[model samples]
Target: MSYKPAHAGSGPASNSLRILETVARFGTGTTAKEITDALRMPPATAYRLLNALVGDEYLVRTSDLRGFALGHALSGLVAAATPPTVCTAARTIIDEFRQGVRFAVHLMMFRSASLRVAEEDPDYPLHSVFELLRYPHASAAGKLMLAELGDPALALPGGQLVKVTDHTITDSGRLEEQLAEIRVAGQASEINELEEGSASLALPVQLPDGSAGAALCLTGPAERFTAISEHAEAARELTVRLKPLLF
Candidate 1:
């Protein structure tokens, strides 16, 4: 993990920023020792900065307390940031998929547990991504990321869900039930939920550690989609193809 920090040899502020960058790049389970080596910092300096970051809520220790992940305190920064640019290789794959399907294919990604679109199908416009992010329950890609969390309720508003359509899952209980099913199925769907005649199907894009941090979704008129199995086959292949490039 050793590398020179981009903003090193300056002072506490530069040191702190480097520490945060390292933790973010490594994702969850990044330890103090790793940060120290990666940033080439003294043990004392790294520990001091880590403690301050944790106290400020910019970083959180994993449940095991041996590693760290970005914390909710930085949600605002994540919310404002655009999706990471799709690399040439990944873009080529997504373009090929879009050529084969009339339906809209979205490369939905997450950062700090918030949804971002890496690429949206150009042929068919995605109605309102803002609304989908605003109400996760109304979007399959949204629900897919929510299902990956240790507790779905953390991201959900809880109690009564705001109904986006007649088919939207309004009851919190039913939402939980559906999330459970999504976990078992490794897929999520919105059947006339987000809007009348609009449906979406999502298959998770697995991270190296095997947790789903991104989704490969096809969205369009419900009639445009057939059985879930039909969409799942191609999506599963895309997930496999994307794993190395995406992570």
Candidate 2:
């Protein structure tokens, strides 16, 4: 994920903006389940919303039968919508987390209705998976962001669960259960779901309205991250300390 601010070329997004944006961002067709995993909406809600978008011609169905992309008419709308400002507000906190964690750190905004990486540090030498946000249930950041939706502590797009990895949580019932736990715990963790032998810790960035506007994460190899319990503890502390900056 590259850290960048919203530009003038961006446009305003509506409630249904995610459906089109997800397709454009991911650059591939997506299923309702994938949308739900990335956006954190209930399965039924995601299905209904995506269906509506398709019906309205804001999204187009793909040949695979379970994927969608921006409809012909909606492409220009995304280019005009502003990327989002949450990144600007939280960049300091995100950078701090990276410095302390000594690993790649990324911040993802709940944009258009999906999790979009708003920033990533170049010093870490890891590519930000902001692109994967388009592929629901593809990464730890996506799952954490989706989990935050139960509390709307993280703004999320609505869609069904999509499976990206063998370890990825594709079962809606189980994924919901995991999200409930994350909401109560104030954070979430994942191993090898996004990438094999990789682990991560994440927490939601809440807005003044108590909505989760984005998520902050620390990621690295499984060995380095798993051995450092202190890192997890510190990340937890950072999330709590930064709560004021977000909410």
Candidate 3:
């Protein structure tokens, strides 16, 4: 496999980037003439940017100087932007539970105060991970994360908690009270908070420091919340199974 840029587009750097992209797509040993032909850029424009890129270490000339290859400079940029990936073993474990459950099971990792989806159920897609993370007080997984942080205020954005549904907790005092309960109970639940007829329950994958490193949330129709609670033992077992991979 070859290096691929995480970002790309037109700008002052477009011509130079186009040349590098041409080389990447064609792999190493791609000639300058090939780049210009593929990009349909004038020879002068292509050559100028190519030279500038080579000089700046964004590209490198081939060992024989007959072509170009991606330069080492790209390594730093790629490493900085790349997020961690779930391994095969972790996926297998998560998949087994997802296959057995009727609910939308999501595995979310906590990075600082934010929760990022590690994996979402394929059969039932999540409503909106972005919106849920933005309003951590509105979802079971988000509430579990906030409780683990031990400070709801740190996770809450400025102003009142935005009301996604009438059942959503809008008051900080009330949210804090729930967070306290979660701290004691080691789990969190939501009812018609994020959506009118949806509910969820979350159990933490706790870390050595006693804060949650990840969460396993089960979501389904609001009427089936009792069904969600029936799996508390199963969710706890799943979290223990995931502890080796998630944190």
Candidate 4:
């Protein structure tokens, strides 16, 4: 995990970045000599750039050992580069929901006990509340995603839950009880847990095998998202209407 010096030259560094970008776009490794030939740089300069990239963990030595390829450090960046399958399919539903509610609509994916907001509507207000975008099991969407891990019926993985907000449920005992409620209701709700005066309603997006792939959420001011409020009802209705697209 060696790091480059802070005062590296920008001109040559920019060229190296261009080389990495080309390799990534091509989806394969390129030999240092090949890169030099392509970019019209000297062989020694190309080798220096390649080793620099390798040390940064953005590239790995290929099987040939003479070439370099993208590494796992680029995996998270790539995953975030494209919208997930569920989000791509549910875009219409999400857009309409955001338009109708005039509030933020977030699509969250479950990674262990945490919920990561993979997609959000830019036009939707209250953007700062979701600025961090990723959080532990606290919001309605987070809880809905967490509930997937407890379903004996779904046979998903289980692990120690991580708490992100003051209102987060850390105890396994209480979490299991709450998950049961999510299983029965097919949805979850949270009020002022992640942020004071903010609330949300969320329902699991079940895949073809009946396993939860993600959660669909609508977030807004607490006063606007009551238990039996029209906003909540509309979000629930949107979730139901979007069900067919998940497959």
TM-score of 1: 0.69
Regions more than 4 Å wrong, model 2: 1-81, 86-93, 125-131, 151-160, 240-247
- Higher-TM-score candidate among 2 and 3? 3
Model 3 per-residue lDDT tens digits across residues 117-187: 77878888889666787888999999998887777776777735889889999988999899899989999
lDDT of each: 0.82, 0.63, 0.81, 0.66
Per-residue alpha-carbon lDDT of candidate 1 for residues 1-247, written as tens digits (9 for 90 to 100): 4455546466888898888899989999999998888877778878999999999988999999999999877665766485567789998998898787777888888766667878878887788767687677889988998898846655556533778888888877888899999999999998888878888899998999999978888887887668543767887899899989999
Runs off by more than 4 Å, candidate 3: 1-84
Write candidate 4's Cα lDDT for 1-247 as tens digits. 2334233554776877777876776667677766665666666666787788789888899887867789776665666555556646578768766766655788776544344566666765434344234543556776776677664223222444445556656676876788788889888887766776777777777767777767777777888775424566676676666668755
Per-candidate clash tally: 0, 20, 0, 0
Model 2 quality (TM-score): 0.57
Model 1 gets an lDDT of: 0.82
Q: What is the TM-score of each candidate against the true structure?
A: 0.69, 0.57, 0.66, 0.55
Candidate with the greatest TM-score versus the true structure: 1
Q: What is the lDDT of residue 134 in candidate 3?
A: 83
